[model samples]
Target chain A: MSADVELQKVSVSFGNFYAAKNVSVKIEKGEFFSFLGPSGCGKTTLLRAISGFAEPSDGKILIGGQDMAGIGPNKRPTSLIFQNLALFPLMSVADNIAFSLEVRGTGKVQRRNRADELLELVALSGQGNKKVHELSGGQKQRVAIARALAIEPAVLLLDEPLSALDLKLRQKMRTELREIQKRVGITFIYITHDQGEALTMSDRIAVMNEGELEQVGSGHNVYEAPHTPFVASFVGENNAFYGTVISTNGDMVRVSSQGKDFLAKAGDLKDGKKHTFQKRDKVIMFVRPESIFLKDQINQADNIFSAIFKTIEFEGNLKNIYLSIDGVQDVRCSISNAVETATLSTSESIELKFSSRDAVVLPVGPLAVD
Target chain B: MNYFFNKNGPLISTYLIISIGFWLIFLIIIPQLYMFDLSFRPNIPTLLRGGPDDVYTLVHYKHFLFGSETSGERYNYVDVRVFLDTILTAILITLINLCFCYPIAFYIAKVASAKTARLLIVSLIIPFWINELLRSFALRILFAGEGFINNVLIKMGVIDTGINFIAMDVALYTGLNYAYILLMIFPLYNAIETLDKNQLEAAEDLGSSMIRTHLRIVIPHAKAGIASGCTMVFMLTAGALATPVVLSSPNTFWFTQLIYQWFNMNDNWPRGAAYSVVLLTVSVVFVLLMMKIFKVKIGEIVR
Candidate 1:
């Protein structure tokens, strides 16, 4: 029942401002795809373009290989779950789920049965008769999903639908959403700002920044092999080093920052081009928190630094150690709580090391704002 | 009562309660009770108090129903016609006001930009600052034989001569519609403004057309406001005095005019009280019937 969606250089602009600029990507049928970006980064606008609520100023949108120009939201083979859920407060859950069917002139008994079946699919069985407000927040979320699925759309677009829930419910709903997507076998295009959500559920993720797509890859690829500085910093916490490339060896580049040299992997040479880094080429290096280790815990590493331990932040399963390099830049490193490193006091000098493959070096460009 | 006192403090609460009591008793309840008493009795000379001729009777109500014996008509066609005309015209005016004000309210609340909405609301309120009587007179002049509209029509060669808008009851209809427009609009606006725009979009996104979206989502949500606005406009139009009188023509005979004539011109307070009670009772019942039809609760309407 699912159809692949393709965008050919789609752009949505409001006169002088571009909400979504020249974005082109293909979402495969039955694939769980996510657009991940910060607030106002145009991920929602891209989703709206697919759902036909917004018209792209340039290029074409093809759903199931059919052009979608001049088609309205209702005429399209898509359904949208709004950020607020948008459930009708005046209606019962069954009525809300059956609304699309009712609009198509379906009989009441059949609509009710379909609504019941959808409710069961969302794990909210026998909850069809309750008013919207009578349900808890999680129940309402499930009802919204059932309502969207009732239309049997080729593609379902969700705009931060789980954002209203608490942390525990959000985590639970994430898995449930993934399960429902698998069961329905429909193309699910999810939009969210939270990196954890994008990483956990998406079959593939598109990282967007300022109306442009920074990268499109799997969870592992975007986190471990980011193509741009924005994708590196936005997807996860990273220790950014502003430096210049002093030496290049094959796919590895050695960058020096503040007279301290570090080795990191270079970005892939695009289009089978054998591009080599030149000497004195200014670059930015990113090292993930989990990649950095205490020098004593590692056998040997390509790069090592001496840093002053500032403070320790205890997250239930992991401990985040804040450190400063040469009393200037803030560096963070995460280790398991099982490691008994509590003996180390604050402001103590500590040696840290990371493998060359753990850090990436790319050309200096825009980074994500906190 | 305790909550009120706690919220406002003893002194202010006492003052507010006393003021409300005075207004309800002396201004409203007492007068209405007096009218009720008078409506059940015959109109007689002051010296005939407690006499046989001054006894409580249904004579005034019967006079309202059947004309006076001196007129020699089996049934009171003129007064009855006027009574029915007043009700039907009032209903018509309410419907007309709703038709015109609904879109205006929607535009202000939803479609217009914030700055434009503020400007539109301010513009809607500015005309109402003037007194109703003054506005009605202005409308009369605008719709008169050689008034502004007729003169413009004549100049534009749309008509050979001026249109008699007054005699056709156009002036009265326009005056009353203008007079009670805000009553219909504000309630509708207040209701529509609180509606989530997402619901409208969701309905449309679910393959519902524009008309179906309004019928299922927007109208159901705005039902309270519609009922409130319709009830208010209907009651106000039925009891309206100044607009119908000031903008009156040969054909425009309002029920209030008859009540006024009975009280002032004929000095028959009993018949006037009877007519007043009848109009009030009918209006209240009609409003309740409308509320039932629309399935709107009084609490929702008041809210």
Candidate 2:
């Protein structure tokens, strides 16, 4: 059974501080939706609100078109998997998976059979009789998922369940979780601070900051065309330039930063409108590191700047070349390993270029804190 | 031993070891060994203590099962009844105390805010500053014929006359429950506090009711604390002397009182030693049985 969840202007406030403020969104049934944000950004709080552990200070939550006001978590048709999994250590694996059914007065034989079925579904067959502690960390995670699914909840809410696993295991479980969600055909609301994870697993991602939704769209749409400066800076590495709008034409704007004029594509304003920036209106322009190319790589571009190379950071497949333009903004240029390496020493002058279409200019606002 | 020496230096280590040795030998081992020896021997005159008349016998231990025929009693009805009554009453007190303290412990550890929890802890512990004897006496006054509670009930027209708490053994039960309640609350709080709050929320999210949550998740997690708390409370209530004496009516009899009579009033140390050994053995066995039933280990409880 799957149910679409809708939040109508929901706000969760703790006295003067709001954990989530005026959030309204509709999650489609059988879709993998993720709330992606940094710590203290209220993503987990919003997940808890849907699971009924946290009541909205204002507004309503509807599941399957039923209002959830005054309903305790036990009565809600949603299950939550905690960050730590919270499997009963004293119980066997089968018992842990079948706890919800047991509490609902299911017969022991049926419970065991259901538990075994779930174990095999999670690719952990014949591992039900062992104690919970006897399982590995990933095994415990599957057991927690089985326990949550045993209730046949219309929605499954996971609050960073793979955060505890190591990098390799976390990556493996990400695909596993996505596969499980598809097989179950239920609405899955995932909460995470990892942008890459959100991009990889979610059909649609909601980017949140300071208790408010910054942007909600497909992963490709968000990364390529972010609506806010926070989303542009937070989702991935970007070199930001502070300047004022010199002129506006169509959907492109020319901005002057540090005695230099640059042409850039104008993005939507904070209010989700096409903002036509007036002359001398303060704005911040963002360009992704990968978009900036070495002068030799791209012969001609709309924007070109020369800077002294500061350093080059070596990754396995790519290299990040950091440079300073007039000692003002630190610019980073990421190049693939397949490209020819620039034979330039530190402090050497180099030319960098990027197209105006690849750069986005937003109204000056709060950037994501590192 | 070597770690202690390195940690504290040889001089301080020697002093600590000597102190522990002296305590174990003189205070615990010697006294228990003496009592065990005396329980197997007969009570005789001092002049014939080492003589043939002072022989080892099973008479003292047998006296517990079969009464002294000189008193014309068919069985040791008074002592045996008192012993059984003590065991049953202690168990009841433990169950009642568990019911009373579990919610309070859960509240302080999980539900209450930090400030409220601090206030509650201070309130619960402040009453324990007074000596146990004084506390028992205070309870006696609270349950007296013209006590504060009875007086308030009468003035409020809730009762025609004051209920006899002492006559009904309510006073003793209240006294014992009050005396060992802190012992139960702290262990339970410690265990329940270590539980991740997510587990409780997880159970709730999985459609488990509040009562079932406790039955499945919370109580099992806190079993170690419960086992330790119940063990301490049961032993303390069964061996209690001052509270029962001060709060129980004349008709009530405690097993400790019979042992007191044999040792002090009758001046029969052998019989008293036999009764003491029996009570200690039974209490230890009972605690072990409970631990087995609950499937808890001693290491877990201590942790």
lDDT of 1: 0.91
Model 2 TM-score is: 0.97
Candidate 1 interface RMSD value: 0.5
DockQ of each: 0.88, 0.84
Deviating ranges (above 4 Å) for candidate 2: A269-273, B1-7
lDDT tens digits, residue span A259-332, model 2? 88999999865466776789999999999999999998888799998889998988879999999988878999
Query: What docking tier does model 2 reach?
Result: high
- TM-scores, chain B, all models: 0.95, 0.96
Instruction: After superposing candidate 1 on the true structure, give the runs of residues whose Cα lies further than 4 Å from its correct spot.
Output: A269-276, B1-11, B47-54, B69-71, B155-157
Per-residue lDDT over B230-256 for candidate 1, one digit per residue giving the tens place of the 0 to 100 score: 899999999999999998787779999
Error of 1 at A188 (Å): 1.1
lDDT of 2 at B274: 96
Each model's total of backbone clashes? 0, 0
